[model samples]
Target: MQTVAFTQMKDGTTEEYQFLRSLEHRYIRSLPERLEGALQSLGSGLQGYQISRLEHSLQAATRAEADGADIDYIVAALLHDLGDELAPANHSQFAASILRPYVRAEVTWVVEMHGLFQMRYYAHHYGDNPDGYLAYQDHPWFVACCHFCERWDQAAFDPSYPTKPLAYFMPMLREVFSRTAFDPAILQAP
Candidate 1:
């Protein structure tokens, strides 16, 4: 069928649901391409920085790789700021949600908390509490998040950094997004 017969969920048939599920699976398989497009769009995102948002992401990913991070960490670093254009107020959480289904819980948590941890650098200039991340200091992944912000996210804005191009990370991104979504073992918290 080209489309479902029902407009509402209460009226959907078994066959219709199966067809929709198949369509969804196909769309899911294309997520890596969509994500790459989104990252490319960041080239025109928020201005005023020495480098573009896409460059910042490339720098972060490059730093993570140079640090000997695993595939999950490298991918997470590359995407941590992806939501800046669409969800500027909560970009960290936005990126983390996208990564949650595929990467380990630690990487997801670090991405989620990077925004708060990043405040330690410039929030004081705006008269905001820079130490707000302290609230989560007792959490198991707190230090990880701090390290992520300090080493990858916040430090990636340099114009001179030898950032890798998007093509360099395509295979890693495809591999991560190719994983079965919401696999229990992958989502398990450490």
Candidate 2:
């Protein structure tokens, strides 16, 4: 196992990002809230929002489990879109920055690629050949996600997933909430 230590704050500062260690610490801490925030944000578009992003994340995590991923991967699978709430853009990239602390490279890779893989699945659904999705599944990252999905904590954490009460994400989100990669600093408030 590998671990990185970085200080996590509700709002990040230049000092917080001084080293990879601090960055990693921030990532681990922010994970849960971002998970819930993303779900809530995505689900906001719905009427009753019955099938929330949180639900989707859980389902995706479940799917990852069926596919065979590690706990980290499962957590990644569950919370990959935590950033979709506001940006709906490269939120995973932002998530990567936030999760730098808790997740390993392998787990981070899976989350980073989730949006792309999701697009691949869309393409496959439209005769684009779901192979793209399958190919991702074949990758070690995907395998890790599948294995990770199998774990369920029901409270405190389920492999550090579905982050509850946006507060949790605050700590980790500070690490990766940057507006741009060229400039490594969080632009918005957490």
Model 2, range 1-190, lDDT digits (tens) per residue?
1332434564554554455567665774554554555556655553343355555556555655555655545556556666766546796676566555555666566566555555532465677654454566656567544333223212212333443443443343344333233232322112
Our model 1 lands, by Cα RMSD against the true structure, at 1.0
- Candidate 2: minimum summed lDDT over ten consecutive residues — where? 149-158
> In angstroms, how far off is 51's CA in candidate 2?
2.5
Off by over 4 Å in 2: 1-42, 46-50, 66-68, 123-190
lDDT of each: 0.94, 0.51
Q: TM-scores, in order shown?
A: 0.97, 0.46
Tell me each candidate's RMSD, in Å, in order: 1.0, 12.1
Query: Lowest-scoring 10 consecutive residues by lDDT in candidate 1?
Result: 181-190
Q: Given candidate 1, what's the lDDT at residue 100?
A: 96
